[model samples]
Target: MPANTAPIKWAQRSDSLYVTISLPDVKSESITLTDDKLVFTGTSGANEYACDFEFFKGCDAEKSTYKVLPRSVQMFIVKAEEEEEEFWPRLLKDKAKEKNQVKIDWDKYVDEDEEEEAGGFDTSGLEGGQGMGGMPGMGGMGGPGGPGGGMGGMPPGMDMEALMAQMGGMGGMPGMGGEGGMGGMEEMMAKMKGDLENKGGDEGEDSDDDDLPDLEES
Candidate 1:
């Protein structure tokens, strides 16, 4: 048969070889092969299917000879099936959850440490103005005589402006003498003018004194 016809099914029986092939749209026919090459004598279809059976070692129904087949032909017969699972994805999710938990615990520990460092000291039963050893602005038991006691001595309804002026003077700003502190830019300018006038008067007095020559009857 020619190469374009339908495929041929070869079956091997004890001492004979039987070949059955379907002809076009008609019935199939069985042919006996006496030699290695089998030739078709009658024509059944326009296309002919033929192949050389010299290498077809006989087909056995009970024993499969696929292992003895050529590597290229064996590759086309065996198929591999793959199995998929979600093992890695679940493990990754668990690891991420553990990491997030660790981060939360770390943040909580840092916040607790910050609070303890800020002002969480045990200061109960201690008088409001009493000194707590080595702590600045505190003094022993008796109230109001401590280092920061001025805050306790402010008189009722005291003028804030006067207090600030006193503080400014103690803070050392030029020209703001004693209790009259930092008298704005206008006050500083006025003081400067007065100083210049005094200096000018002193110079004038020195000039007049120079004009009054030496009283030595020269």
Candidate 2:
């Protein structure tokens, strides 16, 4: 009698999908998923193997629903090809050699000295009386609080006017007395306090002013 071939068996569960193919020998090679298909490569000893047919194409569809198992099926056997050696390793070696042949430009790297030369910085003006503060808190000369008073004990080399000007111009801060200036906060607080005091003093001031008549000849 001819050797009976069994069909491959497959099963699907909530967490996983499985497929089994049988070879003639009990010790076949491992199976793998390649290009979304299951590939069974037999190892050195296997000539043929057999697995259940229900896993292959055209099994009972109604029996294999989401919750249930399909009808029982017989096994099928497939002949295994002899394993081919040395093919994969040589292919990888050639690919690596091809990749290493690619050239990269070393000239693209920038030198540190060249980068510094390209950056513009001048130190000529940073000399002599050029040092900050001819006096305390008064940079250069003729700073605030008049000559020699030196900004009333403020730090040396500190110039309030230049600092304010630089802050206003470069940092987009408001001018000294503008609406958004620091002066606005002080002026607002002073006005609030004056208004509150005037409310209490209003009646007394009115009475005193009324009691005093305009100057007339007696």
User: Alpha carbon lDDT of residue 174, candidate 2?
Assistant: 63
Candidate 2 local Cα displacement, residue 95, angstroms = 37
Cα deviation of 135 in candidate 2 (Å)? 76
Best by lDDT: 1
Residue-level lDDT of model 2, residues 1-218, one tens digit each, is 32233333332222122233333333433332221223233322324432111222122221111101122211111111224311111111234432332122122222334544433212122111111112221123333443344544454566987665655555434664466575564466788999989997986567666778799989
Over 4 Å off in model 1, which ranges? 1-6, 24-34, 41-43, 55-218
How many clashing pairs does model 2 include? 16
What TM-score does structure 1 among the candidates reach? 0.18
Instruction: Please give the TM-score that candidate 2 achieves against the real structure.
Output: 0.17
Model 2 lDDT, residue 151, Cα: 49
